[model samples]
Target: MIKILAVGDVIGRPGRQALQVGLAKVRESMTPDFIIVNGENSAGGFGITRKIFDDFINSCGVDCVTMGNHWMDKRDIYEFRDHPQIVLPANMSNVDDPAKGLRILESKSGVRVAVMNLLGKVFMKGENSCPFAMVDKMLDLTPSYVKVRLLDVHAEATSEKQGLGQYLAGRLSAVYGTHSHVPTADERILKNHTGFVTDLGMTGPYDSVIGIDPDSAVRRLRTGEKRNFEPAKNDLWFYGMLFEINEDSGACTGVHRLRFPAKDS
Candidate 1:
C-alpha cells in the first residue's frame, strides 16, 4: 500500500507550527509514504515564502507543496517558483507564469506520484480557465510511469470540487478540495475507486473565522469594511487527509480525514 498525506491550507506561522507538532505525532504513529501540503497561505495567510517552503520540505517532512489563488501573493515566490517540490494552479490563462502547475515526484520507496494543482472559478477571483479541461490536459501530459496521482482542487464551491472529482474518478488516484478552511464531513471513495473530499480545511486556529483573527473577521463582516486580516494564534490544529492506494492498480483503498489539535490545546 502506498500511503499519501494531503494537508490543507497552512494559514500562517501558527499553521506552520501546528503542522510541525501534528506531523510529529503522525510520523511517530504511522509515517506516510508521501506528504503533500497546501502552502498557498503559509506566509501570513497570503502566500508561501522560501523559508516556509524549506521548512515544509526539510523540517515538516512534506514531499510537495500545492498552491491556490494566492499563489502570487508573496513576491518572493517568483524567485523559487521553479522548485520541483512546489506546484501552482494550472488553469491560469497567463502563459508567462514561470511556475508549473503539475509535478511528478518519486517517493522514498520509489513510487512515482503525480500531483496537480488547480483553481476554481465559482466564487473565486481571477480569470481561471476551465478546470475540467485543464485536468484533462494534465492527465494527458502525465508520463506513463507515474500511475498514482493526486489533485488538490483549491476551490470555494463544493459543487465544482465534487464535479471535478467525479469527472476524473478512475483516471486519478485521489481528488481533494481546499481553500474553504472549514473541513467537510463528506469523505468517500468514488465508484471508480478514487478517493474524494469536499474540503480538507485549514491547519490553523479553529477558534477564529477560517484562521483569521476573530475580532478582525467579525468587524469586517459586520461593518463591510476591508479590514486587515491576520492569522489567529489560538486553538491551533492540523487538518489533512490520508489515502491508502494500491500500487499496482493505482486505486484508493482507504480514505481517512485527519485533524490533530495542538498537544497543549
Candidate 2:
C-alpha cells in the first residue's frame, strides 16, 4: 500500500506553527509514502511567501503543495511561475499568467502520482477557466507511467465539488475541496475506490476566526474595520486527510481524516 497525506489550507503563522508542531507525529503514526498540503494562505492569511513555501516542504514534511484563489495575493508571485513546490491553480488564464496547474511526482516505490490544482467558478474572486475542460485536458496530459491521480478542487460551492467528484469518480484516485476553513463531515471511498470530500478544513488556530486574532475578526465583522491582522497564537488545531492506495493500480483502498484536537483548557 502507498499511503498519501493530503492536508487542508494553512492560514498564516498559526497554521504553519501547527503543522510544524504536529506533522512529525502524523508522519510517524501514518507512515505515509507522500504528503501534500495546500499553502494558499501560508504567509499572512492571504498568500504564500517563497520562504514559507520552502518551509512547508522542508520542515512540515509536505511532498507537494496546492493553492487556492488567494494564490496570487502576493505581488512577488507575479514572477513565481517557476516555483518548485507549488502546483499553480489550473483554472487561471494561462494567456497572461505564467503558471501551470498540474504536477507529477514519483514515489520511492516507483508509483507515478499526478496531483492537479484547479479553481472553481463559483464565489471566487478572479477570472477562471472552464474547470471541466481543463480537467479533461489534464487527463489527456498524464503520461502512461502515472498510475494515481489526485485533485485539489479549490471551490466555495459544495455542489460543484460534489458534481466534479461524481464526474471523475472512477477515473481519479481522490478529489478534495479547499478554501473553507471548516471541514465537511463526508470523507469516504467511492464505489470505484476513489476518495472524496467537500473540504479538508484548515491547519491553524482553532479559537480564532479562520486563524486570525478573534478580536480583530470580530471587530471587522461588527464595525467593518480592516485592522492589522495577526495570526492567533493560542489554541492551535491541525486538519487534513490520509489515504491508503493500492500500490499496483494506484486506486484508494481506504481514507480517513487527520485531526489534531484543539488545545483548550
Candidate 3:
C-alpha cells in the first residue's frame, strides 16, 4: 500500500507556521510516501504566492499543490501557474487558461499519480461548468497507464461534494473536499475502492471563524461591513487525511485522519 497525505487549505502566516511544526512531527512518524496540500489561501488568507508555493514543495516536502476559488486573489499566480507542482480549478468559468487544472506526477515510490482540481458552482459566485462532466472528460483524457487518481473538489455545499464522491466512487482512488475551512465528521471508503472526505479542514487558527479574525468575520457576516480582513493568530492546527492505496489496483485499502499535536505525540 502507498501512503498519501492530503492536507486542507492553509489559511495564512499562522497556517504556514502550523504546517512547519505539524509537518515535521507527521513526517518523522507517519512518513507519508506522497503529500498533497490545498494552498489556495496560503497568501494572507486570500491566494497563494509563488514563494509560498515553492516553499510548500521545496521546504514542506509537498508533492502537489491544489487550488480553489481564491486562487486568483494573489494575481501573481500567472507567473508560475504552469509549474508542474501547482494545479488550478479546471471548470472555472472565468479561467481562460486550462493547463494547470490536471497534472500527472511521479511519487517518491516512482508511481505515476493523476491529480485534478475542480470548482463547485452551488452558492459560488462564478458560473463554472458542470464538475461531473468536466471531471469525466479529464479522466478520459488521462493516460490509462496512470492509476491512483486523486481529486480536490474545492466547493461550498456538503451535498455537492458527497454527490461527486459517490458519482466517482469506483473510478478514482480518492475524492476529497476543500474550500470550506471547517472539517467534517464524515469520512469513509466509498465502495471499498476510494477514500472520501467531506472536508479535510483548514490548517490555520481554529479559535477563530474559518481562519480569520472572529470579530472581522462577525462584522462581515452580520452587518455586511467592508473592511480589510486579518488572519487569526491562536490555536493553530493542521488537518488532513492519510490514504493507503493498493498501487496495483488503485484501490484505497485504509484511510486515517491526521491531526497534528496528538496527545501521545
Candidate 4:
C-alpha cells in the first residue's frame, strides 16, 4: 500500500502560515509516501509565486504541486514551464501556453503515481481544449508502469466537478476538485476502487472569504468593485484529503478528509 497526501488550494499569507505551522505535523501523522498540494492561489490570494512554490516544496515538504486558473496570473511562472515537479492544466497550452498539465513521480517502493491537473468549463473562460477530452487522451497515453492516476480538477461549478467525477469514475485512482477553498462533504471510494470528492477545500483561514479578507470580498460583491483582497487574519485552518492506494493495482483502498483545527489569531 502507498499513502498519498493530496491537499486543496493554498491561498495567500494565511494559507502559507497554516502550512508553515501544520505541514510537519501532518507529515509525521499521515506518514504518506508522497504529498501533492494545490498552489494555485499561493501568491497574493490570486496567483502563485515562485517563492511560494519553493516554500511549498522545501518548507512544507510537498512532493508535487498542482495549479488552477489563477496559475496564469503570474507571468513569471513561465520560466519554470518545463519543470517536471509542478503540474499545470492540460488544456492551458491550447494557444501556446508554457506549463505542462500532468506530472509523474516514482517512489522508492517502485510505485508510479501520475498527478493530472485540469480546469472545468462551467464558470471559467475557454482558453484551451475540452478538459473531458483532454483527460481521455491523457489516460490513453499513461505509461503502463504507472498504476496510480489522480486528477485535480479545478472549477467553480459543483455540477461540473460531479460530472467529472462521474466521467472518470472507473478509469482512474482518484478525482478531486479544488478552487472553492471550502471542502465538500463527499469523500468516497467509487465502484472500481476509485476515490472521488467534489472539492478538497482551501488551506487557509476558515473565517475569511475563501482565504481572503471578508470585508474586501463583501465590498467587491456589493459594489461590483475591484479591490485587492488581503489574506484573512483570523481563524486559520488547513484542509486536504488522504488517499490510500493498493500498490499492485494502483487502486484506491480508502479516502478521508484531513482537517486541522482552525487557529484563532
Worst 10-residue lDDT window for candidate 2 reads: 91-100
Q: For residues 1-265, what per-residue lDDT tens digits would candidate 4 score against the true structure?
A: 8988888888788778887666766866768788898988888777777887887778777889898887777877887756778988887544223236767887546678898998887778766677898888778778877889899998889999889888988778899999888799989988767899999988888778888788988998899786777777678778888899887787889998888864534
Over the stretch 1-110, how does candidate 3's per-residue lDDT look in tens digits? 78999999998988998887888888888778889999999999999988899899999899999999998899789898889988889899866344568899988999
lDDT for each of the candidates? 0.89, 0.81, 0.89, 0.81
Candidate 2 residue lDDT tens string, 2-73: 888898988788788788766866866768788889988888899888788778777666888898788877
The whole-model C-alpha lDDT of candidate 1 against the native structure comes to 0.89
Q: How close is candidate 4 to the true structure, as a TM-score?
A: 0.93
Candidate 4 wrongly placed segments (more than 4 Å):
93-99, 262-265
Candidate maximizing lDDT:
1
Estimate, for each residue in 1-265, the C-alpha lDDT of model 1 and write its tens digit: 9999999999999998889998987888887999999999999999988999998998878999999988888999999988999998989654223237889998878999999999888999778789888888888888877889999999999999999999988889999999999999999999758999999999988999999999999999999875778998999988999999987788999999888786444
Model 4 score (lDDT): 0.81
Clashes of each: 0, 0, 0, 1
TM-score of each: 0.96, 0.92, 0.96, 0.93
Candidate 3: what lDDT?
Answer: 0.89
Tally clashes: model 3. 0
Residue ranges of candidate 2 with Cα displaced over 4 Å: 94-99, 262-265
